[model samples]
Target: MGSLGSRVLRRKAGLPRGEAAAAGKGGKRKRGGAEGTGDSDSDGEAEREERLLHLRGRRKKLKSTSKYIYQTLFLNGENSDIKICALGEEWNLHKIYLCQSGYFSSMFSGSWKESSMNVIELEIPDQNIDVEALQVAFGSLYRDDVLINPSRVVALLAAACMLQLDGLIQQCGETMKETITAQTVCAYYNSAGTYGLDSVKKKCLEWLLNNLMTHQSVGLFKELSINLMKQLISSSNLFVLQVEMDVYTALKKWMFLQLVPSWNGSFKQVLTEADAWFAERRREFGGDISFLESAQGSAFLPVFAHLRLQYIISDLASARIVERDALLPSEWLSSVYKQQWFAMLRAEQDNDTGPQEINKEELEGNSMRCGRKLAKDGDYCWRWTGFNFGLDLLVTYTNRYIIFKRNTLNQPCSGSVSLQPRRSIAFRLRLASFDCSGKMICSRTTGYQILTLEKDQEQIVMNLDSRLLTFPLYICCNFLYTSPEKRADSEAQLDHLES
Candidate 1:
């Protein structure tokens, strides 16, 4: 090596010959003398290239073309090629980015009068579309992703549908479906119907079916329209509480709210207020015509027709309420009484054991709907009141399991028990648990099945997993306790009406 002072001066200038020699020797030692300095130098080159590649990747990610384009081009309106005016607001936008929307593309590509214009005025017919929704809808064109807020989804959906933005429309539909609660379900359902979002509409209907009765609310009752109430009552999928009697009771409360929407009160007070209101109506009408036959109630007659009066009148208290309310026409009750009398005779004298097989049509139209709520994870047993054609089925919940017992001699029942050696009934069991917002946390269903039991026999209807068990579980059941009957009675009623 050269003198230390000279070597130091040369090192500062550039890699001198002496320093290169020293580095060569160090590389040989690191790679072993046999491999020489060539392999070591190649390793150094590879490491440097890898470091440069990582730096380039980080720089590219930081730039984020989507964000840059959105901020500069959309927000700053840089070099905008066209202008859009709607809902008393204006936007400076580029046609190239706007073409991502089908509406703008059609306008530009077609032989329309406004195709070549630098500014275009849009007609916004949907009342839901507002300025904020239009801003978000326009901004989404330049951004790679859009964040949807549940509260603003309806308005955004209206804007997207008007602009024919399929991706944004689909996102809005997904957001609505995911956010459905008692407060939002009716609005979502109505918007879905208007926008032709079939999947979202179906999801809203399912949520309503599960929660309408299991978790009733004054807001929901007020929101439910006459036509929607008709649809819900006419379907077997409705989750009724207690029995058919409870369904009529709910309708009476709902009808009261429909008429007196401003009368806000506690849930327990609904029935008392409804009775008082109807009593006033009775006095006004001179108490001669039934409420359902009168002008005010005739509009709801179609909904009431779906109630299985045979099940409702089986209990003395319920029948008495039906008589006292005078909601149904006297002829309506008389006809149901005659039909049920024959059915009772068939069960007692004709040896009608019960339903032998599941008749989907018969069950969907006339099944006895009922439900119960389990407060926590524990052992409990209960029974719904009504004759149930003397089947006397009892429901039990314990150890995360639901059991259905046929009471004959092992357990005392409120109603008469069938003494037959074996009896069959068609049933469908459903259980669900909800979060604070009325969103379903977990749910299960038995669909539709037929179960046969010997005297005092019990069977496991549902086995809950420990992982999925939650407090305040609601269980709803649809039971068809009698065989399907001929349609002669219904046809005769229609015939009388036609005359």
Candidate 2:
């Protein structure tokens, strides 16, 4: 009897019906033959299976019923078709039920001492729920009163993800991406380079690469600041980005271009010098040279920074477009070269015997001497300036001059040297290019003063006799070349500094 009652209680707890009748009928049964026992056992097994199936069906129905109850209680059955509870419930979901009524709060939290509590609620039919009310409620959750504070952006993202609110998730992600600081970005980079929110991770990668490749602020990035441009180029492997030559080329050109307007008239000079400095370091801390090499093809930045700088020697020697025999107006040249001259003259107005008043003869002689200082060497290297085929071929030396031309390409002609000495030595061009070195024969077109003299302290002018000079003539000139002794002394000075 005791065992029977316990069995009845167990069956009653498990199933709501038939347990009392089964217990009342049960007691003892006599043993029977094998066939009868087998038949009876089969019938019992079938009944047990049926009961299990029924219980499973009931549990499934209960799930659907619970979801419907919560939906109607809180969401007003607006999402009646949505299966909200098939997925495991989140911690905040209980709060959702509690907010609906005191009865749910007491039942769910297991604090049911106050059983008399009731809700003053009106039944809202699913169809009668005003669409505007739902819209306004969701809108309140989505609305922004200010630029969403970056500090709260992550929290908003977590909530959006948990709630499956895609729109809010996207908004928070975009806001965080936009407001991210370099420090924060580096932190994200250190931690596998994502916001840890899966939805934004893909979009964040796109944003980060776009910024790395195109943002103006990339120039200010600390990696670029400390000569770590290579790191950016290499670390981009994290994204499997093939660091193309074009991208690197574009980055380098863009960096130098930003400095252009700041250097003003000397933009080209500054850019070239900057490139040279970068090149030296590049070789020392070597990587692909093609990165800098691509700047040659860049069109956004001017190829030549300062037109006045006649020659720019760069890492890549062949990347220059030089105009030969080009003519520039003397006044324009003077404006560029003598910007400080008038100012200096103005300051010297009161002193009669100022530096400018130094005898024109001496000045000319000294300049010619300086200009010819390098002429003693056979090669006579001059920094090439544009040629003037008109009035005279101008070669810039210590002073400007008009030079006489000579014989044809195959046969060389010699010319008579004319030197006039004043305070400075000046050339009065009545010289002849002889056909033979043996005799100084007079060439055609005499008295053509192809050379002229002018005094600007550091500059020289050479006027070429176009009439005498034939095509492909041998012309030699020099400027800014120091004597071997001077060269050695300068080297010593540099060595001293290095030491």
Best by lDDT: 1
lDDT of 2: 0.34
Candidate 1's residue-wise lDDT over 91-154, tens digit each? 9999999999999999999999878999999998889999999999999998868999999999
Model 2 Cα displacement at 411 (Å)?
47
- Give the whole-model CA lDDT for all candidates, comma-separated: 0.86, 0.34
Candidate no. 1 TM-score: 0.86
Show where candidate 2 strays beyond 4 Å: 1-37, 44-48, 77-244, 249-499
Worst 10 residues of 1 by lDDT: 11-20
Worst 10 residues of 2 by lDDT: 318-327
Q: Evaluate residue 433 in candidate 2 and report its C-alpha lDDT on the 0 to 100 scale.
A: 29
- Inter-residue clash pairs, candidate 1: none
Steric clashes per prediction: 0, 27
For candidate 2, the clash count comes to: 27
